[model samples]
Target: MNAGNTFEVEVRGIRREAETVRSFELWPLGAESAESAESGEAYELPPFEPGAHLDVHVPGDLVRQYSLTNPHERHRYVIGVNRDPASRGGSIRMHDAVTVGSRLTVSAPRNHFPLNEAAVHSVLVAGGIGITPLLAMVRRLCELGRSWDLYYCARTESRAAFLRELRELADTCPDGALHCVFDGVPGTAPLDIRAVLAKHGAQADFYCCGPTPLMDAFTAALADVPPERVHLEYFKAPEISTPANSQAFTVTLARQQKSFVIEPDRSILHVLQEHGVAVMCSCREGVCGTCETAVLAGEPDHRDRVLSPEERAANRTMMICVSRCKGDALTLDI
Candidate 1:
């Protein structure tokens, strides 16, 4: 809150969370100075909900999104990143290039996957690096006195993140429980995803974030469940769509009272920002919601993974970063 959307943050500490994952403790410079003014310690971070994430700009001009792991803290942020061999230089940079004194630029917290306060029972399922968001959700559930259950799946104990915190939650939870299911551990039973999805009651909501295979399997297994009862978080864009099938279109910025042609090669976000439009955007691939603009008029081509099927059909808003115009001319509230 003390800095702009993108601000400089120093890596205060670093600890190896797993064989491949490392946790980074970042402190906002201004916030740290303000906190040290009185008690000499910055705590927590600007208020963020359970499933919030920050867009971190790493070396080599690569930007990656990582979820916040601590829901109880407000002044500082803790993010766990796994050294991905296939990374486009982001995860590898975090693991190998960054150190305690390294400084990085990060976007403010934003939540695409949020918690449902009305649910009496919450079923939190996480896999591998996907445990970041769900870890915060568990802390939030404990703080709110809500009943919940966690199905944490990992290949082995050495590859899992937040083991200590999970153990503490398992011991302290009143009505909920923790189920640690590992596949690499000898003589340990594998996690049954179908059984976990089937056991939850009607009032219980299912939330999961993990590898694509795990998420796809969960989607297929929970197909019979009500659509409203199931939720998911995706770091990767599901699919990219364009207006190529249709003719060229025009975009009218309602507030600016300006119009521009949307060509085949150029995207709406590109054209808008080029025209000096002050629209905030991150994850140019359209996974993050920084460039979500209101749809006051005309239909839009919904291609981003952030919006649900119902939201896309409603034509209320769209993520302009990757989405396009479907009609000849589209009007926006921008």
Candidate 2:
């Protein structure tokens, strides 16, 4: 609940989409009535593109980001949540405490995984709850009459969240395709990432969001593909290791006219917070792009999963939470 900007929404509906997954429909506080939505009345919620997510402020001061699954043109936002065995207070609270008509604060929609609408073709690969964001992309692509393919993977058929909706969508699109892979079923092997990429050829832009192992395999299989054509979103940050010979660096805040020494053991975020510098951050592991800062002058040793490889090479910005300066001195537009 510590975000800089947020608005209130009331839960209008909650439906169990799968065995362990539930879809929540949220509408702005004043326009929460079902009649308004049905009547085609104007509801003034902020517009969002596909692959956008909202930071939902749940009870107990916990904030979690969930991708929007509904069509981008809709007035309300829909998000799917899976009950994880490893409860982190957010998912458990959403399942046990939140009910219809509940009021919650959520950040405005922000997108880190954007669809390349101009690409010749789009290929979407999703696993489990990762289907949330890609579903929006599929809806948008259908609206635009674009060619696309979706490969939805899950542990079992019962675990797939929006299978029926996806099938209906595929049936309507003459050029779109949908493939479901349930690898955990008996006698079924995991989807071969290499074989899938080989079929798409050179014109397709690939998008993937899934568990760590699935994403890792997809990334490795597409190693030769141009960075611009490969888009990925991570649910959690991967393990990051610092170099053994890492050295301390100095950061100069341009606006504040201040300089601080960033120790090798401590992150730049921690040092800035200790000095009373206000920087909003969440998911300190670098999966969320909350602490992204402009780099006036410095080559950042990018360790964040949020940024693409092309962006890292540009060195125009850096995530303060886990990334560090490549050299001894750096300049930032604090």
Candidate 3:
């Protein structure tokens, strides 16, 4: 991630994908100022790798991470959001209230689950709204004339977004490279992993992003293949085994010069936000890096999905959403 390259962007457009999913396009608000200064008109932002995602700050709500669905060379940043009924009201508000002109603060793109370099072929499996990241990969691979196959599975055709474009691309591609499997598709079974693996063998690199059960099924089905060759992007954090009735703890904000006690059942993020402190965050499950804060003092029980062991050891940052303090109190840079 480029430290000085961050930009605050505004929503330029919004498009609905499904009843629960929407796509938003963002552009830098300072583009005109930069261009007027003859600093060279900012071209479309640099291209992100296949699995890159951006952390978007939704203001009153915590920051949230969304997969980039737009092509790399596009002049704007595009992200697809699904209105998760179980969400802590973030997705619901984003889907219902956010408009075309809304200003959303965003972090630069980051890639933790990049594409495999060794494999000559690629197999992308996307379930439901999980198609967002894979769609970007498909666009890039197509532009490069690379060999890849996309298997998109959904409950029905109505719930599937970008079906028309995907089908059109597959038709023009030499072979039938794109396959859509719907549960309602009469004679066809939905995403036959066993058959797919048996036919494709272990030669191609496999990428999957979707619900936990779908990912788990793929992981089990591809047990014969090398684990390193299989990549999975999870939208949520894996269930943790914290003490059933974990005790509450106090977190001190060094910059704000304040401290708050988190309830046994609540997270540190809730406590800080209740005190009117604006902490960066997204994906309360700890999967995304949006809520990461600088740990100025104290040991952190890191529970985020993005940070590596080395990152955790650095002790410079911590995701407060799901992560906890190891001791009585943790001091944050705020």
Candidate 4:
């Protein structure tokens, strides 16, 4: 990791990976550069794992996240971003305001979807821009000489980022295992996730990141596989309609000897923060694991994407941002 939890970096390069996707290369500021403010001197970035991501501070006080596509590049972190029309000024602002020499403050790498090093085989699946983190994992697996294959899908060939690089990597492996599926290509068959997943044994480690529908299909396809062995990273939280049976509940902070009542309209995190409780949070929809809190004594309504079905059943922790107490009163360690 970096020496500090956060640092400032200058954008050094921008490369178009596809029609809408562009890669940003960040060069971390060094001592001399900090003093000069324009010097070319920069320090080697800290090491990051295959699935790690950095929280980037964009122009509108927005802390949007982007996955690091390359971990072995010592001097810079390369992240890909698609110019999303529906973005809340994050990706759009990055595309418009950021260029070579644009300075930005960023958090150190953090990973929730990590690669399992000891697996007998690995299956990497990606959809559109979701290929960023999986590309990093593919690079790591190739470096270790591990057996792995990637199934990448996009709406069209022009929108598929890193195709050339992935093709080259698969070329190094036997039988060229990179599978690309493009829906817009003439006579291209729809990718049957069931057929793709069935080719691999249940013991193989499966990793997927993509649009919600695609991920749901993957989850359904892996019903026979152990849930713990299947890893997923969601760019957006799964949509769940409000439960008509939802009720107001109370949360007790065991360590602080504090209690707060959460109305059905408000989340536990909102109530706690209103009462001056400190909790770091991101993606309030619960996809990111930032607001995960220890559940010391009560059953929590688990709603986060970070936890597995088994972890949810254990009730060890819950994401306070979107989850609530299952019982009348929930006890938290903090």
Candidate 5:
């Protein structure tokens, strides 16, 4: 991450939202200083829309993207982190080493999963930690007096983060409703996404963020829905098999007037980094939009989950971390 493009924040408070989930409240440096306390006023941070995320630079030299959970109008940014046993160090560090008053670097907000503010009604589906982004959407929708329904799925109620807050919000809004489904409970059945969609009707815009299985089910259920009416974001890249016939390709950096050869086994990102190229990158697995580079020429074999189908068809930009040139050579804006 670029130091000039990031902000320094202090952890103001932390709460255990669930057994494995911890929510951190962050305030900009000096926001909670004696001056603000004496003045009894709040200090504002950079504005962001709902569904935005921050590239938090954590210990172990790892950068992980976590969605903002609070309303966009807030003075502080809130993020919930879930301790994953299979984590590659980010979440574990957040849960174990981080604490109140710890200073952290975070990039300004970026939103690939923006809520459609114009939609008359919205349906939000969340699985486990996926609720982070959707919670912000619900808060924004409520503020706008828009109708929305949320379907929250978790292994059990005890494992659901922000469950009490969601329920409280639902009770405050007559136009909004909340549904919970715990599949791990003995008597409970898994959420029937198809049935849920059917009951909600086709006019409501749908949004989902969850594990691979839930994401797959939600996507399949919305196969007939219009692209603009469906929204989703992935916390990690799906397990996709790379094409067996990938061939060597040459990439030309238009601005730098430099060229490099990319092997079939190596990623474009790795090749660029090896050549001393500076690119802002986080999740190299193609889940984060950090390594997205403008495509000046040639068709790209898109592999990232961040871009929509329409965007992929346009071939205007490609995530260099996992995507590559379709032909023998390609040009990039660098």
Candidate 6:
């Protein structure tokens, strides 16, 4: 989707999965609605790549990133949000205050880790909420008649959001290819990543998205494979490695006409927010592109996972969450 285009949408529906998780359905407002309806509109926003994600601005000064879980042909945008009690306030606000009629601003979809071209056979592994992007990939693979398999692991069957749908899709495949591994199943064992890899490794491309521990295990277990053969998309950015004797810095928002002194222990985004500067952000770890802004003047110490090498070379956009200004004073577009 175009980076410049944005939409104002209202929550059309909300469904709670558990105490901490919820699914939200949104629709575009005003004339865009009529235009979409006329064209048999599926998504309120532009069609996105299979693994694309969007930045959602929630109430209580919260901005978060969520993967688009619905197929590209669907009429509405769907996101599954898991509330984190330890979160700064984003997830809590989303679960508590967001309702069927609540309104929010959403940025266009962004894809930093698009599917690779050499993926002849696909193997998708998902854990819990990590299934969002993989669900879209499954749909795309099915439509293309590509060889694919999905291994979905959850704490229990009831906790899996689209268990029924996944099972049906698996049944309809040319050959049975879906495997469900429940953590608490009486008879079934936990997911055996090694066994799965041993059987699927030769000609398949492995794409994994999950929690930190799961991803970490996959990384360690798959170390023998070529890096290009394995793909990963994280819901959170990698942690920053602090340097010795790092000093504080100054940041200037050229558009907003504001400036702030950011301590070494604080992130630029946190410092800006503390000063009451309105900035958009999600996935504060830096994987999501919601908090990205244009760099007007200064060298940026790029630390985010979303920007491409070319995008970074251009030095135009920067993810404010984890990225820092390299120079003593930095200017931003706000």
State which candidate has the highest lDDT: 5
Sort by lDDT, top down from the best: 5, 2, 4, 1, 3, 6
User: What are the per-residue Cα lDDT tens digits for candidate 3 across 24-143?
Assistant: 888766544324423444544556777889877775756677888765543578888888889777777788778977887677887866776446788989999899999888787777
lDDT, model 1, position 319: 92
**Which of the numbered candidates is closest to the native, going by highest TM-score?**
5
User: What would the TM-scores of all predictions be?
Assistant: 0.86, 0.92, 0.75, 0.89, 0.94, 0.79
Q: RMSD (Cα, Å) of candidate 6?
A: 4.0
Give the lDDT of residue 219 in candidate 2: 90
Per-residue error for 170 in candidate 3, Å, reads 1.5
Worst 10 residues of 1 by lDDT: 37-46
lDDT of 6 by residue, 72-127 (tens): 64346788887877767777888888888888988777776677544778888898
TM-score of 3: 0.75
* Superposed Cα deviation of residue 264, candidate 2 (Å): 1.4
Worst 10 residues of 3 by lDDT: 32-41
| Steric collisions counted per model | 7, 0, 3, 0, 0, 2
Candidate 4 on 231-310: residue-level lDDT in tens? 99999988889787678888999999999899999999998989889987767888877677889888888778888787
What lDDT does each candidate get? 0.82, 0.88, 0.77, 0.85, 0.89, 0.77
Q: What TM-score, to 2 decimals, does candidate 6 have? A: 0.79
Q: Clash pairs of candidate 2?
A: none
RMSD of 3: 4.7
Q: Cα lDDT for residue 283, model 6?
A: 75
Candidate 1 residue-wise lDDT, 204-273, digit = tens: 8999898877787788888888877888887676553544485568999898899999887888899888
Expressed as tens digits, the lDDT of each residue in 15-108 for candidate 5 is: 9999899999988777665357334344556667888888999977899999998765445789999999897889999988999989998988
